[model samples]
Target: MATGDEIWEALADFTEQCNNNKRLRKMQRDWTKILHFKAIDMDDSFTMKVVEGEIVKNDKGTVGTPDIIVETDSETMCDMFWGDINPTQKYLRGEIKVKGTQEDVMRIDVITAVIWPEV
Candidate 1:
């Protein structure tokens, strides 16, 4: 079981990584969104926002109206951020659950591919 701090750190790092990528920023330039992450294993939630192609993380809570909500175990989330595992695979296997419009979800997939491409 990953600790809450570990999960938060991983998520922070993940967002930072995405924000630092020129390709990612260019791709997400027009896609402003608020995302909510629910760590089922830790029973905690956090928020992240993408605006003007930059990622801004907010503390746990209903910071704003969410465009997408993701639910997954804390360990799985950590692994995904640390590049130890692929989120797309987990989602395909039903391990990670996401609630969002098809377009929104596809945007995330595209972002993930840019950062953590198949390896």
Candidate 2:
């Protein structure tokens, strides 16, 4: 199994490369208009970046952070990163949870579709 840092690096590299893609670029630009919520597990700290918005810090000592927590439900993004694993299942299986506005959740769904397009 890949280590946490390895996965984050891969994702970061992929997103950086995607920045060069027209479609992805357009979507990223669009996303800037909306607030983004990113839950990053930084080895020893769990940092949340609100992208172009506000990011409130979490007190939890990070280490096992998720790649990104889309407030909304995006099976595609989940499947892409976590193949065959449904968010609902994870939730039911006591894995992931969210604490944000409903709008944040809804917007995240759209963002997920854009970020994790089937390549």
Candidate 3:
């Protein structure tokens, strides 16, 4: 099993690569809703999809999948991940480099901000 840090690293890499993937970019650009999201913090990884406001596990991919439905404690979690920091800007400023959509990048920042209002 992968450690939490390892899982996080992989997710970051995976999303980054997925964002830059020409095919994925083209596909996501035409769609508005995400099918699912899987992510990992440390000890746990999960997958879940939104179905009429209920989150369910339909499939599995990476160990630390980005499913917000299964692992998250609340519905608001969908917007929670991005606000922690302006990771994209940080990356450009030599703080952190991410590998996902600009939308994904901004969402993470939004999550950060919501979670840590003091920061």
- Residue 35, model 2, lDDT: 25
lDDT of 3 by residue, 2-99 (tens): 34444445445444444444544443443332334333333343333323322223233433334222233222122223233333345466434344
Best by lDDT: 1
Residue 60 lDDT in model 1? 64
- lDDT by residue for model 1 over 1-119, one digit each (tens)? 88878888888888888989999899889999999888897778888888977886657655788999988988987787777787788989999999999998888878878987773
In order, the Cα lDDT scores of the candidates are 0.84, 0.39, 0.38
lDDT-superior candidate, 1 or 3: 1
How well is each residue in 58-101 modelled by candidate 2, as lDDT tens digits? 22233233434433223322242432344444444444455545
> Which candidate wins on TM-score?
1
After superposition, the stretches of candidate 3 with alpha carbons farther than 4 Å from their true spots are: 33-119
Candidate 1 segments exceeding 4 Å error: none
* TM-score for each model: 0.92, 0.41, 0.31
Span of ten consecutive residues with least summed lDDT in model 1 = 56-65
Clashes of each: 0, 1, 26
Compared with the true structure, model 3 gives a TM-score of 0.31
